[model samples]
Target: MWIWFHKLGSPPHFYRTAGRLVPWFGIPALLLLVAGTVGGLAIAPPDYQQGDGFRIIYVHVPSAYISMFGYVAMAVAAAVGLIWRMKVAFAFAAACAPVGAAFTFLALATGSIWGKPMWGVWWDWDGRMTSVLVLFFLYVGVMALRSAFDDASKGDRAAALLAIVGVVNIPIIKFSVDWWNTLHQPATIAKLSAPSITMDMLVWLLAMVVGYTLFFAAVVTMRLRGEVLLRERGARWIRELNAHA
Candidate 1:
C-alpha cells in the first residue's frame, strides 16, 4: 500500500493512469446521461404532486449530490497531499476545483429553475441553499488562491490548506435540510426507508447520479493530466508524453 502511494506520487504514473481512466469513464458518462435525461424527461410519469415541474429533479438532485461529493473528495485529496506530500494528490485536488464549481453552478441553476415552478420563487436564503452557495464560493476561493502565489508549490500548499479548512462545510451542507426547517425537502432517496419514490423515478434518478459521477471522473482525469504536465513540464517523461500527444 505504501509502495502504491509512493508510485502514485510520481507525475508520470499519475498522468498515465488518468489517461487510461478518461475513456473508461467518459463513454459510460455519455451513455448514462443520455439514457437518464431521456427516460426522466419523456418516459417517466410526472409527479402526482408537482406535475411536470418535477422533471428538473433529474438534473438538480444529481448535480447537488455530486457537488457535495466532489468537495469532500477534493478535501480528502488535499489532506493526503498535505500530509503525505504527494504531488499527484495535489493535482487531484487542483483538478477537482473547477469541476466541482461547475456542478455547484448546475445545482444552483437547476434548483432555481425547479423552485420557480414549485415554490414560486427563484432564490432563497434557506439553509441547504445557502450552504451550497457558500460551497460555490469555497471553490472560487481555492481556485483564486492557487493563482495567487508566484511559486506553484507555495500556491499548491496554500490551496491545500484552504481545502482542508473548507471541509467542515460538507457535513453542514449534508444535514442542512434536516437540521433546519427549510423550503427544501428532506432526505427521500438517501433515507432509511426504501426510497419514497417509485421504481420508475428511482431508476431514472439513479441513472442520472451515475452519469454525473462518470462525468466528474472523466473531467477530473482530463484536468489532472493537464495539471501533471504543467507541474512536471521540465521532466523528460513529459517531453516523451508530449511527443506521443
Candidate 2:
C-alpha cells in the first residue's frame, strides 16, 4: 500500500495512470448523469407540495453536496501535501479549487432559482445560504492566494494552510439548517434512519450525487495531469513525453 501510494505521488506514474483512468470515471459519470436527469425530471412523480419546482433538486442538491465534498477533498489534499511535502497532493488541491468553486456557484444559482418560487425571494441572508457563499469565496481566495506569491513553494504552503484553516466552514455549512431558522430545507437524503424522500426520487437523487462525484474525479484527474506536466516540465521524462507528442 505504501509503495503504491508513493507511486501515485510520482509525477510520471500519476500522469500516465490518471490518463488511463479518466475514461472509467468520465463515461460512467456521463451515463449516470443522463440517467439521473431523465429519471428525476421525467419519471419521478412531482413533489406533492412543490410540484415540478422541486425537480430542481436533481441539480441543486447534487451541486450543493459536491460543493462541500470538493472542499473536504481539497482540504484533505492540502493537508496531505503540507505533511508529506508531496507536489502531487498540492497540485490536486490547486486543481480542486476551481472545480469546487464552479459547483458552489451552481448550487447557489440553482438554489436561488428554486428559492424564487418557494421563498418568494431570490436571495437571502440566511445561515445556510450565507455559509455556502463564504465557502465559495474561500475557494476563490485559495486560488488567488496560490497565485499571489512568486515562489511556487511559498504559494503552495500558503494555499494549503488556507485550505486547512477554512475547513471549519464545512461542518457549519452542513448543520446550518438545523442550528438556525433558515429558508433552506433540512437534509432529506443524509439521515441516520430511512431517508425522508421516496425510493424513486431517492434513487435519482443518489444517482445524481454519485454521477457528480465521478464527474468531479474525472475533471480533477485531467487537471492534475496538466498540473503535473506544468510542474515537471524541466524533468527528463516530461521532456521525452513532450518530444514524442
Candidate 3:
C-alpha cells in the first residue's frame, strides 16, 4: 500500500495511470448517464404525491449524491497528501475541487427547482439544505485560497488543511435532515429497510448515481492532466506530453 501510494505521488506514474483509467471511467460514465436519463425521465412512473414534478429526482438526487461524494473524495485526497506528504495527492485534491463544486452547484439548482413546486418556495433556511449550501461555499473557498498564494506548495498545503477541517461538516450535512426538523426530506435512498421507492425509480436513481460518478472521473482526469502539465512545466515529461498533444 505504501509503495503504491508513493508511486501515485510520482508525477509521471500518475500521468500514465490516469491516462489509462480515463477511458475506463469515461466510457462507463457516458453509458450509465444515457441509461439513467432515459430510464429516469421516460420509464419511471410519476410520484403518487408530487406527480410529474417528482420526475426531477433524476437530476436532483444524482447531483446531490455526487456533490457529497466529490467533497469527500477531495477531502480524503487532501488528508492523504497532508499526512503522507504526497504531492500527487495534493495534485488530485486540487484537481477535484472544481469538479466537486460543479456538482454541488447542480445539486443546489436542481434542489431549488424541485423545491419551488413541492415546497412552494425556492429557498428555505432548512438545516440540511443550508449545510449543503455551506459545503458549496467551502469548495469555492478552497479554490480561491489555492490561487491566492504566490507559492504553489504553500497554497496546496493551506488548501489541504482547510479541506481537512471542513470535512467535519459532511456528517453534519448528512445527518441534518434527521437531527433537525428541516423541511427537506430525510434519507430515502440510503435507508436500511428496502428503499421507499418503486423498482423502476430505484433503478433510474442508481443509474444516475453511477453516471455522475463516471462524469466526475472523466472531468477529474482532464483536470489532473492539466495540473500535471502545469506542475511539470520544465520536466522532460512535459515535452513528451506536449509532443503527444
Candidate 4:
C-alpha cells in the first residue's frame, strides 16, 4: 500500500495516470449533469411551497456540496504533503484552490438568486450563509498566501498550514443551521430513514451532487497536471518528455 502511495505521489506518475483518468470522470460528469438537469427542471414536480423557484437547487445544492468536498480534498492533500514532503500532494492542494473557489462563488450566487424570492431579501447573515461566505474567503486566503511567497517551498508550507487550519470551518459550515436560529432551512435529505424529500426530487438531487463531484474531480485532475509540471519543470523526466515533444 505504501509502495503504491509513494508512486502516486510522484509527479510523473500522477501526471500520466491522472491524464488517462480525466475522461473517465469527465464523461460520467457530463452524462449525469445532463440527466440531472432534465430531471430536476422539467420532469420533477414543482415544490409544494416554493413552486418552480426550488428548481435552482439542482444547481445550488450541488455547487455548495462540491465546494465543501473540494476544501476537504485540498486540506487532506496539504497535510499529506506536509507530513511526507510530497511535492505532488502540494501541487494537488494548490490545484484545488481555484476550482473550489469558483464553485463556492457559484453556490453563493445561486443561493442569492433563490433567496430573493423565498426570503424576500437578496442577502442575509444566516448562520449557514455566513459560514459559507467565510469558506469562500478561506479559499481565497489559501491561494493568496501561496502566491505571496517568492520561494516555492515557503509558499507550499504556508499554504499547507493555512489549508489544514481552515478545515475547522468545514464542520462549522455543516452544522451551522442546527447550531443557530437561522432563516435557512435545515437539510432536507439528511434524515436517511425518513427523508423529508420525495424520491422524485431526492433521486435527481443525488445525481446532481454526484455529477458535481465528478466535475470537480475532472477539473482538479487536469489542473493538477499543470501544477505537477510547474513544480517539476527542471526534472530529468520533464526534460526528456519535452524533448520528445
Candidate 5:
C-alpha cells in the first residue's frame, strides 16, 4: 500500500494513470446523470406538496451535497500535502477549490430558485443558506490566498492551512437545518433509518448523488493531470510526455 501510494505521488505515474482512468469515471457519470435527470424530471411522480417545482431537487440536492463533499476532499488533500509534503496532494487540493466553488454556487443558485416558489422569497438569511454561502466564500478565500504569495511553496502552505481550518464550516452547513429553525428542509436521504422519500424518487436521487460524485472524481483527475504537468515542467518525463503528445 505504501509503495503504491508513493508511485501515485510521482507526477509521471499519476499523469499517465489519470489519463487512462478518465474514461472509466467520465462515461458512467454522464450516463448516470442522464438517467437520473430523466428519471427525476419525467418519470418520477410529482411531489404531493410542491408538485413539479420540487423537480429542481434533482439538481439542487446533488449540487449541495457535492459542494460539501468537495470541501471535505479539499481539506483532506490539503492535510495530506501539509503532513507529508506531497506535491501531488497539493496539486489535488488546488484543483478541488474551483470545482467545489462551482458546485457551491450551483447549490445556492438552485436553492434560491427552489426557494422562490416554496418559501416565497428569492433569498433569505436562514442558517443553512447563510452557512452554505460562507462555505462558498471559504473556497474563494483559499484560492485567493494560494495566489497571494510570490513564493509558490508559501502559497501552498497558506492555502493548506486555511483549508484545514475552514473544514469546520462543513459540519455546520450539514447540521444547520437540524440545529436551527430554517427555511431549508431537513435531509431526506442522509438519515440513520430509511430515507423519508419514496423508492421511485429515492432511486433517481441516489443515482444523481452517485453521478455527481463520479463526475467530481473525473473532473479532479483531469485537473490533477494538468496540475502535475505544470508542476513537473522542469522534469525529463514531462519532455517525453510532450514529445509523445
Candidate 6:
C-alpha cells in the first residue's frame, strides 16, 4: 500500500492517473450540476419570505461552499508540500488558488445580487460577507505570491507559507455569522440540530455541493497536470511524453 502510495505521488504516475480520472469526475460533475440546478430552480418551492429569488442558491451556495472547500484543500496541499517536499502537492496547491478565487468571486457576485432584493442594498460590510471577501483576497494573495518570484522553489515555499498562514481566516469566515450580528444567514444543512431547510431543498442542495466538489477535483486535476508539466519540463518523463505526442 505504501509503495503504491509513494508511486502515486510521482509526477509521471500522478499525471497519467489524473488524466484517466478527469473524465470520471468531470462527467458526473456536469450531470449533477445540471440536475441540481434544474431541481433547485424549477422544482423546489419558493421560500414564503423570499419567493422565487431564493432560487439563486442553486449557484450561490455551491460556489460559496466550494470556494471555502478549495482553500482548505489548497492549505492542506501546501502544508504537505512544505513538510514532505512533495512537488505534486505544491503543484496541486498552486492550481487550487485561481479556481478557488474564481468561485469566491462568483459567491460574492451572487450574494450581492441576492442582497439587493433582500437587504434593499447590493453590498454590505457585514461580518459574513466581509470575512468571505477577505477569503477571496487570501486566494489572490497566494497566487500573486507564487508568481512574484523568479525562482520556482522560492515561490513555492513562499506561497505554501502564505497558504498555511491564511488558514486562520477559514474558521473566521465559517463562524462569522454566529460570532457576529450579520445579515447573512447561518448554516442550514451543517447545524448540530436538525437542518433548517426542508428535505426537498436539502436533497438538491447536497447534490449541488457534491457536484461542485467533483467539478473542483476535475478542474484542479487538469490544472495540476499543467503545473506539473511546467515544473517538470526538463524531466525525462516529460521529454518522453512530448516525444510520444
Best-fitting candidate, measured by lDDT?
Answer: 2
Task: Judging by lDDT, tell me the better candidate of 2 and 5.
Answer: 2
Give Cα-based local distance difference scores for all models.
Answer: 0.92, 0.94, 0.88, 0.93, 0.93, 0.93
lDDT of 4 by residue, 1-245 (tens): 99999889887888899999999999999999999999999998999999999999999999999899999999999999999899999999999999999999999999999999999988999899999999999999999999999998789999999999999999998888888999889887764568788898889998999999999999999999999999887999998888887
Residue runs of model 1 more than 4 Å from their true location after superposition: none
Candidate 6 per-residue C-alpha lDDT over 85-128 given as tens digits, one digit per residue, 9 for 90 to 100? 99999999999999999999999999999999988999989999
Q: Model 3: runs farther than 4 Å from truth?
A: 243-245
Report the alpha-carbon TM-score of model 4 versus the true structure.
0.98
List clashing residue pairs in candidate 3.
none
Model 5: ten consecutive residues of lowest lDDT: 225-234
lDDT of 2 by residue, 1-245 (tens): 99999999999989999899999999999999999999999999999999988999999999999999999999999999999999999999999999999999999999999999999999999999999999999999999999999888889999999999999999999999889999888888786777899997889998999999999999999998988877786999988887898
Which parts of model 5 have CA positions greater than 4 angstroms off?
Answer: none
Output the lDDT of residue 240, model 2.
Answer: 84
152-186: candidate 1 lDDT, tens digit per residue: 98899999999989999998988998999999899
TM-score of each: 0.97, 0.98, 0.96, 0.98, 0.98, 0.98
Superposition TM-score, candidate 6 onto the true structure: 0.98
Residue-pair clash count for candidate 4: 0
Off by over 4 Å in 6: none
RMSD per model, one decimal: 1.1, 0.8, 1.3, 1.0, 0.8, 0.9
lDDT of 1 at 23: 95
Candidate 5 lDDT by residue in tens digits, 180-219: 9998888887978878989988899989999999999999
Clash count per candidate: 0, 0, 0, 0, 0, 0
Report lDDT (Cα) of residue 157, candidate 1: 95
